[model samples]
Target: MTQEQVTEFFHQQLGTNACLEAEGYTIDDPPSLDTFIDSYMSGQDIWLAYGSLPVLSQQEWYRIQEVCPQP
Candidate 1:
C-alpha cells in the first residue's frame, strides 16, 4: 500500500493514541510509510508498521515480518 493509505489506517486504528512514545513523535496528520522508513533507516526512531502481509509477495511479507515481529 502507499504511505498515505498506511497513514489513514493508523489514524483509524490509533485515534488520539496514535502517537508512539518510543518514537517520541505523534504520527503526522496522515502517516507516511515512506517517511517512517526514511527515519528508521537513518536510526532516528522505530516506525510503527500496520497492515496485512499475506497480500504481499513472499519476500515483501518476510521483510515486513522481520521488521515488525508479532507479539
Candidate 2:
C-alpha cells in the first residue's frame, strides 16, 4: 500500500497517532507497508506492533520462532 495508507493502517492498528509521530513518522510521509515488512523480515527495527499477536496458536508461535528466532 501507499505510504499514507500504511501509516493510517498502523495508527488504526496501534490506536495511536502520537506513537508513530514520536518515532519520526508522519501519516503524510510514512513508508510503504512492503518496505516496512521487508525491513521487519530483515530484522530492522523500523516499526513496533505492540500486543498485535498475543493469541498465536502454539504451532504458529513455534513457526514464527523458527523464522525469526530470539537473540
Candidate 3:
C-alpha cells in the first residue's frame, strides 16, 4: 500500500482502536509514513504499532468484532 493508503487505513481504525482501548488495552499511535514504509519494505510486521492485546475466546471475540468490525 502507498503511504496515503496506509494512513487512510490507520484513520479508518479509530473506532476499532477506541473499542480495543475500552476493552482495557493500550493502543499506540500509528507510525509515520516513512517509518511505516521502511518497516514494510524491510518485512517487519506492519501491525507492530497496534501492539498486542490479551487473548479472548471465540464468543467474546465475536462480541468485540460486532462493534469494531476489524476494518
Q: Which candidate ranks first by lDDT, i.e. highest?
A: 3
How much is the lDDT of residue 8 in candidate 3?
68
Candidate 1, RMSD to the unseen true structure: 11.8
For candidate 1, list the clashing residue pairs, or say none: none
| Residue 24, candidate 2: C-alpha displacement in angstroms | 14
Per-residue CA lDDT of model 1 for 10-52, tens digit only, reads 4544442332323333343434656654554566753343431
* Superior candidate under lDDT, 1 versus 2: 2
RMSD of each: 11.8, 11.8, 2.7
Residue 21, model 1: Cα distance from true site in angstroms? 14
lDDT score, residue 44, model 1?
72
What's the ranking of the predictions by lDDT, best on top? 3, 2, 1
The TM-scores, one per candidate, come to 0.27, 0.31, 0.66
For all candidates in order, the CA lDDT equals 0.45, 0.51, 0.68
Model 1 TM-score is 0.27
Better of 2 and 3 by TM-score: 3
Residue-level lDDT tens digits of model 2 in 1-71: 65576555655544343443454444344346677656645676655443333566889667655543322
